[model samples]
Target: MQFQHPELLYALFLLLIPIFIHLFQLRRFKQVDFTNVAFLKKVTIQTRKSSQLKKWITLLLRLLALACIIIAFAQPFTATKTALNTEKETVLYLDNSYSMQAKGSNGPLLNRSLQDLYNVQLPSEKISWFTNDVTRKNTSLEDFKSELLSVSPSQGQLALSEVLLKANQLFSNAEASDKRLILISDFQQNEAFPEIPDEVTVNAVQLQPVNTNNITIDTAYIASKNGNNMQLKVAVSGSGDVPASVPVSLYKGKTLLAKTAVDLSSEKKNTTVFDIETSGNLKGKLELTDPNLAYDNSLFFSINAPKKIKVLSINEVNSGFLQRLFGQEEFAYTQQTQSNLNYNEIPNQDFIVINGLKDIPASLAVALQSFSKQGGSVLVIPSEKANLSDYNNLLATLGMGRFTEKVSAEKQITQIVFDHPLYENVFEKRVVNFQYPTVNSYYQTNTNATDVLRYEDGNPFIFQKNNTYFLSAPINLENSNFQNSPLIVPTFYNMAQQSLAVPHLYYTIGQQNKFDIAVQLMEDEILKIKDSSSTFIPLQQTKANKVTVTTIEEPATAGTFEIVKDADFIASISYNYNRSESNLQYMDIENWEGANSSASISALFDTIMEANNINSFWKWFVIFALLFLLLELLVLKFFK
Candidate 1:
């Protein structure tokens, strides 16, 4: 035990004053006559004993009261070795992520947390404050309090382990004897906690929100396109009980396009489809009316206007079938024989079809390989009796394996890789017994390529390598029956459409933000992406025939954005918030109680105080002193 003001303990000598007064106050009696001697003797003996006992008891109470008062003034307390003898360093971590927007007792969870910090009486020590996006070190608690009011929640998230590690790093070189790290957060379960080191002590304060139920528009996509009307599919997901009715709205820019209400069942996910009119470069958002979490309630997306697909076919024979397949209005199809093959036009086409080519020239093979490398898709259909060496040379240049001798046996394509993007939404149902394409004679090749179509004998009928696809036999009336099969239309169309590299509906934040477009740009041309309020040039690099644009800075909010080359509008892109913050589940503090080192903020504070063995007992001592003085007063006034 110790005293805060040890010098005041010298007041204990004042107790001697009461003792001396009691000794000096002893009465010197004068003789007096009594009425009856026997009666006087008995009364004197009883009164003397009782009077002496009462006087001694009263003196003892006075001395006890004086000692108690002196001890209270001295500020007595107990000290432990772990108590802070020198200046202490404290680090406080406040979570300001989007998840903190949930409502708590006072207001928003983050706002409540800020108020709690304001109400706390900080110790006289150097303090540091940390959040997900900012860190202020070695600031006074008053300054930190002022800064805390101005802080708002951010989209960025910080893990518990990250906070601890950062605090440890900040205090690693500090000279203070006692160091403490206090974290206050909702403790969302999205990020995993790392093992904290034993050298640093941490105090975790979890803020629990009232409502955890949330409904979010997880994603949206273009289901189908029919002229000016496009069908979009939106996925809605929720936690907790399903809402009875969820109102969904679609917006094109600021204009409301469509609105609908969906009846949700017990299922966690529900897909709703809406058909809306769309024109060129549509920037839109799909919003769900959910009050629990406003951040994920709306999903931003973009849709590019339909554009003509350019296709070029090079053939040795005058095959009318090649022209008929790509001759639709949506395609700008051009056909040229091998004699009139133009190397310059290869870069301008979205897809190049090499149909029944007798031999591939060295210059033409090099140009085609360059086309494939620059994001252009190629479909190679070799002639049955074509020059093997020429085809092999072309294949070798493209890093595709060489074609060996042709197989003269007839084979049927019995299996199709339906899961491939080429066959997406093509057939309503899987055809178990359908007419299969037959190849009379096919080239044998040894290559590490994905087989999209396989023969009954487990041989590859069609194989693809990156953007380049190879067919074992030509699509001719004499060589095979593929031209008459139903698979020919979708197989040729999806290849052309996919080669254009359609813009995605949306992109998630905090990821590699790069988009590949089939449009070519000049050397001095600059690509800029903009929304309704802002515009900036993005980092762009042009490849052989396509341009790649990378977003240098992340947008402040999720919305639809447009890409342009100087004054010409290129495409539309959408961005959405990462869904990781939507999960409100948290790690229970009870789980950490079992661990000797881990504890809650309140528990940790109590432990720190206990370990320091430093507590002011002066309040209790003062109460005791006051009670003793009251007892002494009552005895002097009425006890006699």
Candidate 2:
């Protein structure tokens, strides 16, 4: 026990006044004669004893009253481990991440946290408030409460290490002798706590949810597409040991496309495939019937509509096979010799095939480099009698390796990199002992590029670097049989198909914020993204022909959105909630031992007050002092 104001204890000397009065009153007594001797003697004995007892009682009451008053002014209290000091600071970290939306005893865990804050008895110290996305310092208790009313579950997730580091920085320059951090969170297992410093003490309050069994649509992607029919694969995951069977639905704007039941009994993670007929832009969602944790139950996705590809063949010696391969109904193919090539049409083409160009012009090399840098793909087919220096100059300008020399030895294409994106979903099964393309003579180049097709002698037959693809041998009638080979169709078709910018199927909220659009907006036109509920203009920056837009304020809900320019639909975008908050596991209380933590807010406040060492017992002491004085008054009034 200790006194907050010990100087007031000196007032205990006032008790001497009451003692002196009692001693002085004893001397004022005088002797008296009795009328009857026998009666007077008996009465004197009884009256003397009663008078002495009353005086002792009265004196003790007065002394007790005086002592209680002095002790009340001294303000005594019990001390804790930390000694009380003048200045103190408190930092409160309230987690508002999406994981706090889980149900608790009262309502949502976030609501329970708010109720706990309302019942907290704040000390007379500077208070700092921290949330996942917002931070305010030196706020009053009332102000903090008012701000908390407007806070909701946020998509941004803050790890425990980040919160601790911020708290340490906030208290680093504090002049207070005792600094404390109060953390209120669901303590999700996805977030790990870091080692805390001993200079500042931490008081953690973990809020546990009622239900931990949660099933969510982890992710969805296109498995395969054949003509108009596409096989969409969706991965589902859960948290607890309990098995569950949930219904999964796919929707396209208000129309239900398909519905199926998924059995999550044995596997924690299961991938289900759905076949659907799609036309134009495919915008939809994969939803599961789980209301407990609804944030991750639905995933939004969009697949862009197919567009016609424009292919331009710049040839010095025209090859009939090149035109027949690219001049299909889906492609707008045009061929021109190098002397008759128009530089003005370069930007409009998706792919440019330089076929057997003996000499590449300086101006054409610059245009090709600019075209490749702006997301255009280039396919180079070198001539057998090509000028090595001219080809090397063009290759050097385009950041590709130069052809060293021509080899006379014949080689066959024996290896193909089937795992490359260019060959993704191209074959149903691997073909073994198949016929290979043979080249009588080819260029022997030392290029550090991804070898998509290797020769029989381990030399590169076809290599790619960024948007540039190099074929070692030309498709001349006397030189090679690559044009007639089965690999010729997909190799050229996929090259032109991949040149156009394809919108991503879906983006995870808080992870992807930037997107590139292939649209070339006019001077007066501005791009805007909108959903059914809200619309906003994003931060746009133009690079070459493409425009990159970054979301300024991300949407609160996940769904498919449309990007429009002047009321014309440019493309579709989809967003889904981050899966980090779907896991409901948390840290146990036993793991948090010795961390100065409490499950109840009131108990934590009591501990902090004890640590302050200034618990005000003065009010209770004053009540006792007044009661004692009342007792003394009763004794003096009635006993006399």
Candidate 3:
């Protein structure tokens, strides 16, 4: 309680004057003529005593009335805060990630949260609200009502620590304003809670699911190829309760191709394989019935005809091993001697090999530089008796290290970089005692590229930098036997394979996904991706023979989409929502430091309103003064 007019409380001092008058009366009773002194003495004693009692009662009533009126004039009041003049800003972060689809008391957790939001009376006239993918600033309830209704599960989830930074962006730049942050989410266990700023009060509302059991189709992929048919493998996983078996279905467009069941009675994770016999493109989807989360219940994928990578080799001393490795069925192999090679065919290949060239011409070196810049890959195997000037010129122009002096030594290839992308999924285990190939005599070069294979003495046997690869020694059967080793197939195969990255079963949304389309387009032409609902042009670049498309956040919806060049359907691709949300575990909201936790949205808003209310006591004081005056009059007129 506080006083509004504290200076007016000086009137309380005047009540002391009434107290002085009650304590001592200054008037002496006038002397009257006395008659019958003996009889009047007894009556005088009784009358004097009664009159003194009445005077004391009247004095007490008047003092009480005066004190009440003085307090009423002071105008006291009670409030939650000391100063109520500061401006208030509120920012609400609502998490609409896929995990919100879990079931709660009423319905889905997201739907229940929506209803809770609708019931809240705004603490202020306006506020800012944001989700994973959208933001509305300083908007009234009526203004953001539509946006809230349209909020769906999203793949772009922000970590709990990131939410604080995102919400702070919407706050006004007033230094004296009171800031409030309201975070609403399921609070998944993987994210860390951030510390709250002292200037801003944080309120967290965590929604819990009644049942945590959820069965999800985790992923789908082509596990193995069976002749013309492929063995499609689907992995399913669950949390909490375990069912005996879950039926899985495979779909090509809308037609059902095959069905299988994954027995989950004994394991939390299981797999089911389907032998698909289709030979052409398949707009495929894998589906299962899961009562918990609908987002991870279905997986979308695609199977398209193989696109062969083009390989060109310009030879000075031709070796027949290149033709056997780049089989006709998979790679379009073309071999041309330097004397007969046409420069027109340079830009049309994906991977080019300068095979054991004794000397490189200036024209061929210039052509290789242009090709490398346009997304082509090159491998240089230096000859024993080569022109140092011409070979160094080509290497320098391609942003690679130039060869200096030749060192004649017998060395063995003893190291392999199994962690490189070229060697991904190639080795089941690291082999240390395998047969190491040796070179009889080789040239020593100075280069700062990643070593694909190293010698026993730590010199680079084969090094690569970006798209340009170099072999430090010649492999002409007379110099080295590296071509006969088991490492040769995967080493060269993956080098070319990575040059044109093939599209996977599905790409996660909100990530950097890039792939190539093997189609030649005219200048100024473009490519777009579309499904049944919408179409969008991804960030793309046209190389000499293919288009490299990169997507970061486009194709927002999860489904099968086709890459279209003008009117032609180039290939099919797919996108899926992230599966991290399928795990039903939740964070411990009670342990969050420096934050006030609420059970629901409506309760949090009610608390805010109550804190800012000011209860004034001036009116109640006025009523008290009037009642005291009535009591004083009654005591004076009726008590006697």
**TM-score of each candidate structure, all chains considered together:** 0.67, 0.71, 0.89
Highest TM-score among the candidates is held by which one?
3
The all-Cα superposition gives candidate 2 an RMSD in Å to the true structure of: 7.2
Candidate 2: where is the Cα deviation over 4 Å? 1-78, 81-83, 124-126, 175-177, 241-244, 309-340, 351-358, 372-499, 543-545, 592-594, 616-640
TM-score of 1: 0.67
After TM-score superposition, what is the CA distance of residue 601 in candidate 1 from its true location, in Å? 6.0
Q: Candidate 2: lDDT of 369?
A: 91
* CA deviation > 4 Å runs, candidate 3: 4-28, 34-75, 79-85, 171-178, 192-200, 317-321, 409-419, 427-466, 475-481, 484-487
Q: Write the per-residue lDDT of candidate 1 for residues 1-640, one digit (tens) a residue.
A: 8888899989898888888988889586554569887888887778888888888988888888889989998998877655736656678888998889988766788887777677655654458888987899888877888998898877778777677778887784755456777778888886556676655566777888877888888777778877888789888877876677688998888889888876666677788899978656777888877776788988888878656778999988666876888888678899888888777899888889998888888988889888887778899989877899999898888787878898888888898888877999887887768888898888887877888788888778788888898987766888788888888888877888777655677888656676677577777877788888998777776766667677634665788887888878788888888888887788775456322343333455566556655778999988988898899889888876
Q: What's the CA error at residue 394 for candidate 3, in Å?
A: 2.1
The worst-scoring run of ten residues by lDDT in candidate 3 lies at 77-86
Clashes of each: 0, 0, 0
Best by lDDT: 3
- Residue pairs with backbone atoms closer than 3 Å in model 3 (clashes): none
